[model samples]
Target chain A: MKHVIALDIGSTSTRAALIARDGTVLDHLRRASGHERGAQAVAECVLDFIAELRDRGLRKYGEAARGVGVAVPGAVDEGRGLALFSANLGWRDVPMRSLLSRPLRNLPVALGHDVRSAGLAEARLGAAQDKDRFLFLSLGDGIAGAVVTGGRIESGAHGFGGEFGHLRVRPGGRRCACGAVGCLETVASVPAIAEAWARASGDPTATAVHAARAAAYGAPRATRIWRQAVAAIADAVVAGIGLLDPRTVVVGGELAAVGDILFVPLRAAIAERLTFQAPPEVVPAALRDTASCQGVALLAWDLLAEAQR
Target chain B: MKHVIALDIGSTSTRAALIARDGTVLDHLRRASGHERGAQAVAECVLDFIAELRDRGLRKYGEAARGVGVAVPGAVDEGRGLALFSANLGWRDVPMRSLLSRPLRNLPVALGHDVRSAGLAEARLGAAQDKDRFLFLSLGDGIAGAVVTGGRIESGAHGFGGEFGHLRVRPGGRRCACGAVGCLETVASVPAIAEAWARASGDPTATAVHAARAAAYGAPRATRIWRQAVAAIADAVVAGIGLLDPRTVVVGGELAAVGDILFVPLRAAIAERLTFQAPPEVVPAALRDTASCQGVALLAWDLLAEAQR
Candidate 1:
């Protein structure tokens, strides 16, 4: 029985999970990212998590795994196995694979974009596993998306294929960190929902989840703001269906916590936008935040399988 | 040399040509589409063209061709080889393969959408030949597009892919024939350009090409309308780039006939909409209205090559 390590580095947290060859979780550990400690320090912390797992595996199974697979946020150069420009995670052009592999005595490591890795997990082990062509959309702190077609995710020319956030939802409305106005992220992401609620309710302390609930329940101000956010999401989703025409559309992240309230209007908005005869299936993501971890595990699992072939 | 008959059926006319195994055009013929003549009449005209080409080829080369290929102007099911619908040509669920195959002694008849067939031609012999991932956009009486990626065109799961006309450009501006509002084709196609010209010169008789030239030379009304049209096209182009991020984008059709008057502003508009990186190389299409015919030729050539393989 062989085992591999899968590390998922996010903006606020660092998580390491040991994935068995059979796709089962053996052990899991979590830690704060403390990204303020700088890139090298944070990476060293990630390495420490891997080392603990490697030692545990060696003591129990009498041998260590051959490699580790990691997933990081933002644009990635999958061919070169690097994470590039994750503004949230404070990482840029980090040779995550090389750094993680070097200290582990030449054990190979694979790196991929977190959202794309999550999409791969869905394609490999979740609801979209049987469906080869679909989109995996995650609306979290900031919005991001990934395209999975014919059993492989499209990484674009620059591995930035699914930056759905900056897609203009409102022309010249909200100025975004990307230096664009009216980006989808400004309207639909978790933080956006909270911000909109603050503006509407004048509370300034409402959580995004609670704000979404108030909006779903049809509070006048909450509903007004929520409707606008949902409308923007629908625009992106509708455009996506028109362009990609996938078999299914799987949505996750913090915004999806509202479930049917979010999907009902989102689906209706998309349907109203289409003039064509056919449309794709829209569904919530099966795995929540843990999806990225599973995706990283799947990547390691694939490498091991490929090596055997 | 083996030869195949290819017919490109458009709204106003039906053009036919004979292509050899080496991709050389043997003979070209033309006929009226006769929208007044109805479906049966149109089918007869196409069949007549193929028969004439077959007889001529046999007389000149002493052999009948292997098969027939027809590129129709509408929705097509390429895998099952069916022309599901055509708004312009008035074709609906036309079992083109069986229809043409029966008359031609049960030989294979390959049927495909004109825009997709044109994209195949561009990918095989035109501007996109050197690129693996590129988008072929055709702007004519209506807008249609095609994606050539990894050397294969994406036909969508239900054969409804590349319908770029329906992409919402202005959001709640004008109702389109496709039932969507603010569709790119509503404001950027040949009719749109012609409409702008008519408004500018106060001459409803002014053609799209002439109007484009007038606008390029600084006619205020023409410039205003043309600028709006350019901005709309740029928005749609940016949207497409954002979604697919292809390496190259090839533009053709009636709008392209405007030449540099169209390309210059259109390119600048697309550039203005881009952000944080490389805009794709936008160029004029190498193949013209005869694109579908050549693409049909490529299909026949592909079939013949595959048979040899």
Candidate 2:
């Protein structure tokens, strides 16, 4: 049973998984991805984490790991095996594959963007099964998205694609991290929802889960704020459907935790605006948080198989 | 040498062609369609137009047509080979395949939207050749678009997809036929451009072509209004890239006639807003007004070949 090791390096944590040829998770582990002091420390910690995973695998299944796949936060050159930029991890032009492969005794390594990896997971194993032409929206921190069409995550020509959060839904509404204004992330993203709820209800730590729970009993502020955020998301989704005509849309990240309370209004708003656009099947992501790690595992599987072929 | 008859029934006229196995037009003809009368008249006109084309084909290639392909504007049900709606042509719930097949010998008929046919044409022979992931935008009497990804046009779950021009770009700008406010067509489309130019220049009969010519020579109002329109288009394109991440964007219809005068600025606008969108090659549509007709011809080719297979 040939397999690949998948690693998703986030700002605060790292997720690792060993994926089998049949798309099953052989084993999985998680560890801290030291983001406190910047690039070098985090990179070294990641390399150690992956090495430890390999050691654990060797102890149990001995040389079963065919390769390793890593999902980074920012721009990456998977073909060139380089991390162009990772803002959260504070890395630039790091030869990630070389760093890990050299220490792992020349094992093959694949690298990809985090959202893209999650999109691959959705296409291969989740709600987008048996279909392509979809958008995998990662709605946390700041909103970013990955396009999956024909089983290929669309990487823009210049590695500047799927920046969905910067589409300026409100033109000049809110200041965003990307130096843009009123992006969907600013209003409809999970953090935005929490912030809006806090500002509206005078509770700074409000969240999507808290709002949904409150709205169940018809809390006025929670209902108003949540509906606004959901409608905003619907606007972005409608714009998405208009442009791409995706067959399915899978919403992931912290926003998905709100479950059907969010989905019910989201679906209605989308249906209302979808007069002439392709009405895609809006659904929740199945794999949850570790999806991108698993997806990156699939990338490693591809690399391993291609090397053999 | 089996073929399909593609009858593109539009508001003002009916066009029919005998498409060969390789998407070549063996022969074609055109005639006026119908008006305030009824769908029965329109159906009869379509029949007569096809008979004329069939006769012309015998005169030119000395052969009868095989299968059938038809592209109708409005909500098409390509899955069931039906036209669910056609506001312009006054068609609703029209069993187009059966009606058009009455002229032929009941050969197979594949139906799609007109812009989708153009997208198929671009995918096969035009600017989007060899590129499966792309979009075809047409600026005509009304604005509409089609999406081609992975060698297929997305007819959507209900056959209404790729309506970018209809997406609400402005929340409270203009009234659209679909009862939407400030759609892309209301600002950046041919009518939008012409209306903008007319209002800015105080000329009632000013056309988009006139506006482009003036803007090319550095007319102040023309430049201001045209730039706004171009900027709006760019904004929409950026959002599209965020969602679709297509590699090529083919612009068709009258506005493309301005050549670089239109494309150069439009490309710059799309480039400015992009962060990580697939580097889409923005170019004028290769096929002209007959692009969709040619796309239907490609479908005609595919349908006939599949029948033989």
Q: Which candidate's lDDT is highest?
A: 1
Query: DockQ for the candidate 1 complex?
Result: 0.61
Report iRMS (Å) of candidate 1: 1.5
Clashing pairs in 2: A156-B277, A156-B278, A157-B278, A157-B279, A160-B275, A160-B276, A160-B277, A161-B276, A161-B277, B4-B67
How much is B208 displaced in model 2, in angstroms? 2.8
Q: Which residue pairs clash in candidate 1?
A: none
Cα RMSD, each candidate: 2.2, 3.5
Alpha-carbon runs more than 4 Å astray in model 1: A37-42, A59-63, A90-92, B35-41
Per-residue accuracy of model 1 over B1-309 as CA lDDT, tens digit each: 678888888888877878876556777777887856766777777788788888988998788977787888767777677777776766678777777778788556788778988888888778898787777889888888886666778777767667777778788778888788888888888887787678767888877777677788898888887888878877777776767777888988888877788888888888877765458888989887778887887786676677778
> What does the interface RMSD come to for each candidate?
1.5, 3.1
TM-score of chain A for the candidates in order shown = 0.94, 0.93
